[model samples]
Target: MNQFDTSITFPNGVTLKNRLIMSPMTTLQSYYEGTVTQDEIDYYTRRVKGLGAIITGAANVEPLGKGWQGELSVAEDDKIAQLSKLAHSIQSQGSKAILQIFHAGRMTFPATLSGEQPVSASAVPAEHRDPNTHDAVPRSMTNAEVYATIDAFGDATRRAIQAGFDGVELHGANTYLLQQFFSPHSNRRTDEFGGSIDKRYTFIEKTLESVFAAVDHYADRPFIVGYRFSPEEFTNPGITFEDTGYLVDKLVQTKLDYLHVSLDNYKRVSIADNYKNQTILKYLHRMIDNKKPLIGVGGVRTREDVQNVLGSADLVAVGQQKLVDPDWPLKLANNADDAMINDEFKNAIEYTPLNAPLYDFLVERYGSIPNI
Candidate 1:
């Protein structure tokens, strides 16, 4: 079987029809009230194309976990109705619906989370502005609050299953709550949840345990479970290659269906001492020991880029490519390489399913949209 087009089964017996996956990228397209909007539903439906699975934008696990004003929510029973619509819409197009569950942590603002000061593993304020809110001063999370948040992850998992999602990917990357705990630059606690390297991992470990507990009880089908993480952080006391190696080894022993590595470039070499010149994806593929699937993502825009990423990891995820052209993988499957991406941004309003908010955000962030 051609690797990218082959069907493979997970440890839990769930099989993805193909290897192409749509990575989760935040699209502030939901209703302000936290319900899924018709535009958001149509957005995902149009993006499925030929992808085997679609990791929907991160959904908040608690009221205080909201990262942006229009992000999807899985925090309550009432949300299941909209979540169900989302799951069915994606699945109806033959894509497995994997909800990316998350808590924004220090990345959120007090105003977004109902006036609660953003909380993190420690009181260390974020070095940069909170991207969405522009600025946010965060506080430390109490020990009890920590456990409560962990339980909230489990609650979110239950909600995902109840809403008929095929699986849930824990949002551990991108400076969220999970990353905040794992990052030395952010986690400075003297308690069991911080300080030593092993202690810092406690938060991720415990949170996964809680989430897995929910899956064990609620997921009667072969539901896939995955973790997304960034290999390194740029801070002074950041997450290093060694730290990621340790974490990868631990993940291999778990029930995780896959480990998704988030990177800006799939082949960018590391400057870390022992692993200088080695790409992060290559390092992780080795550490995983073929015990589980590894998804490599970042700047994968073409068929050749996807092929290069597939050379190291089990699957390739496209974020910006999806923004530019939602039918990326579908075109590739039809051997339509030249037609894979929409090169006409000016005509995006004519052919793109993107909501106005997302279209504006893309042009603002990327500086230029395709001339379509």
Candidate 2:
């Protein structure tokens, strides 16, 4: 417990109260135009009291990049005020808030953003059929368009700072825009932005550099910049753990704040189903040893499961479990013996609307929810 009580420090001298981080999990409850709503402010603030730092759900960088209905966006200036309110709410509760900036690429459907054609590294269509609705194949992005996309990330990062976030996290995992460029199966470009492994990473490298530069100039706060990257493409051949290691090694030299290591992109249904496998954490521990702060996330359900990887990783991230119990970090920190999943809370999450009422209700009642 002594080691666990030790303070956790991120790059740029940002220190957290503890090592329990609330991982970024998407909640599509924002205004259709992607503005932050009052419900969102309440939802995030509810969990801020007992956590180290909170990484927000995916915030689209551009309209065409949106992947879900009601998801928020940081692309526009008007949204900054709402985002600022959300950040202040979390900070008031004593938790640092990091906005997760993302572009969905081909995973976006036309229905989400006014029939706009989705863009990706290459023209390859996604293999999985849409759960919500059938959609058209996405078009491959041109070289110029790729560079423009990088610029969009920079713009979004600047906007996040304006909105009062403690930092910004580049969403590079789950076969999204950034991951699309990293996968050999997805990125078939022969240009400098693709081809060899080093070339394939050019877009992500450039995006990070550009965003860092923007944040450096516009914001005076000690901003932290980290990345969420997939270490492997489980369903795709030629994309193995070794290849991911090479990519991570390259990113380490970029002098970023943290590295969030995830195993498979969300497109892989089989791997997504078996997330509790301890082997994923073991592999991540072996791949990254640079002393940089690392956050490991998968299907972690119990407190012991989190403690098992405490020394091996800097932060233990829980998504589904947290949805079932927002007080999960508090329970684990205090070593409560009776912490268990509230089935009612789980059912509530399905209809929770991704806003404050649900979270506020949970905070008001900290016991297991009886079935309605």
Candidate 3:
């Protein structure tokens, strides 16, 4: 049997139809008010046919957590209708829909939150790699506000269940609020949510408690819950592979269905000085040791790449390739590689389902998303 066509079941008894998943990439196509636009639905509908599951781009759990313009939101109950449409669209093509939820924390801007300052574990400002961009120093989140944010994550999970999604992926990666609380660089608090690494992980622990409470109460059937995280950060005192090991150890003890490590390349080695020898995916695979399925992503554009990633990971997730060729898995299944888009395809927009906004975003930042 084709390995990619084999079904894999998670620890929670939720099984994926295949070993391929669509990485959650922001569309920049949602409405200004955070509602799901038809453009977003059409974009997902076009890409779901041959995947096991599709994770939607981060949806802010609260208004102040909005990361950028055109982001999706699960903050209010009214969004359920449109969100249901999105879930239905993906599942219509046989892919399980997973809602990726997050709070941007210090990664957001005041303008994006309508003049309100962003909040984080500490009043730390994010380091911007781009010289032209200036970031604001976020205000420290009050103890009460911190608890509220945790509750907000739970609320978002409940909304995902109401929206008919098959699962929810906590957007703990990407320097978002969850990562902010876990990173020593972003979390300098002397209180319960910071100080030691265990304290720094308190927010996530409590969050898992809250999220599972919702799952226990609301989910009528087996519903997958996954956590996505970066293995390390480039900043001094930022998250290290060691720190991620600790985090992963804690997460595996929870009811999480899987662990999704975010990376630019599936086989990229560790960036930390002492751990630079091993590929992050392989390192994680050894650490996880089949405790739960690990989803590895990055630069998977072809059948060989898919098989290579699946060698280390139980599932392979495609990011930019999905943008260039939404029907990649379908074509691969039919042995139609000759018809697939190549890196030289400059007019990909004319052939793919990329809406104007996402197409423009990819073109403007072509360096990051190869083969635009």
Tens-digit lDDT string for candidate 1 (1-372): 137888767888899889889889878898776789989998888889788899999999998888888889898899998899999999997879999999999987777877778888987777766534434567889999999999999999999999999999999998899999999988999999998889999999999999999999998787889999988887889898889888888888888999999887888777687886678788888889789988888788778888888889888888767866877787888889987655544445346667787876666655562211
lDDT (Cα, 0-100) at 251 in candidate 3: 91
- Summarize candidate 2's per-residue lDDT along 187-262 as a digit string, tens digits: 8888888899889889988998889888888888788899998766755643566777787788787868888876
Give TM-scores for every candidate, taking all chains together and pairing residue i with residue i.
0.94, 0.86, 0.95
Better of 1 and 3 by TM-score: 3
- Name the best candidate (by TM-score): 3
lDDT of 1 at 117: 86
Model 3 segments more than 4 A misplaced = 129-135, 344-347, 367-372
> Model 3 over residues 283-344: C-alpha lDDT tens digits?
99888988988999988878888888888889999988788788899998899988777764
**How close to the true structure is residue 310 of candidate 1, measured as C-alpha lDDT?**
89
Name the candidate that leads on lDDT. 3
Candidate number that wins on TM-score, 2 or 3? 3
